[model samples]
Target: MAKREVRETSELRAIVDSCQTVRVGAVDEEGMFIVPMSFGYDWELDESGTPRLTLWLHSAGAGRKAAAFGANGNAGVDVAIEMDCEDGVITGPYACSYSFAYRSIMGTGRIYPIASGEDKVYGLTRIMEHMAPGAPQALGPGVLDRTAVWRIDVARFTGKQRQPKA
Candidate 1:
């Protein structure tokens, strides 16, 4: 089983853009909790002209997930795309002969709840654009009041790929 690490930013963005949901892992006094959430993101230059990847996620105003965020902001996120299993290629009759092909990105980041109404709308717009391209872009103020939008400032991330042997 040979695995390859993807180092190019283009490849990483490709994997992220291809996925609809991100699996976020958070921990609190109780324990660890992982939730699959819809998200939107953008790669832009910061004030110092350094490239940055910022992710936007949203959830109900109150929940276990939100509680985890309130208690602790640090989290681990994973996005996977292009997954498939290859079977019937085994020369010998064994389960180990099968292989899976996939591309994934995983990393740790800090999740901060957006407090400003304008920022919330911006985040929600990005999320809607990614999740539903043709959907309405505007988010009502009342809707923003009920929803909690979060921003994940990715610190460091790595991408990996597993290709089925020919």
Candidate 2:
């Protein structure tokens, strides 16, 4: 596989931090499926002043991700950040479409399955906090009992953006 590419550093981290959900792309023997998923960021700096960002995602006992990893351990993913563009040039028979603002992060990495109970709970809590920051959060008593957290250890990620010029 070819090496991952990053157009800019600051732009990549900024978009990832601001965006809520990312479309995780994976392919299986059946076909390719792009899943819109949420993640938690573990942003820190390395000794050399490089930004280290990690995304945490979870799933129930058995889910599509499980099958995707089973099919290919070396699977990768692509995440996208889009804008809610209102009042666009209504073209064609459809209402409107906006491809003006977009930032996508794509890379190759191996998905690490969570085996520890603590890690699973932590991942789940992160998800809850992300979804409803102020709302009263309550996961059923048996959520962790049945849930399994799968963290995507993104080996390398880069951002591609399209924005208006000054």
Cα lDDT computed for each candidate against the true fold: 0.73, 0.61
Worst 10 residues of 2 by lDDT: 79-88
Scored against the true structure, residue 154 in model 2 reaches a CA lDDT of 66
Error of 1 at 44 (Å): 2.6
lDDT of 2 at 29: 64
Off by over 4 Å in 2: 1-10, 70-99, 134-138
Model 1 residue 27 CA deviation in Å: 0.6
lDDT of 1 at 42: 86
- Cα lDDT of candidate 2 equals 0.61
Per-prediction TM-score: 0.80, 0.69
In candidate 2, list every pair of residues with a backbone clash: none
Name the TM-score of candidate 1.
0.80
Runs in model 1 with CA error above 4 Å? 45-51, 72-93, 164-166
For residue 31, what is the lDDT in candidate 2? 78
> What is candidate 1's lDDT per residue for 1-166, written digit by digit as tens?
2257887677777777777888888776687777888988988766875557788999997978887775543343332212112222424368776656677777877788887988998899889988899987866658988998988887777778776456
> How would you encode candidate 2's per-residue C-alpha lDDT over 19-72 as one tens digit per residue?
777666766667777777777656677898676666677766576666675443
RMSD (CA, Å), each prediction: 4.8, 5.8
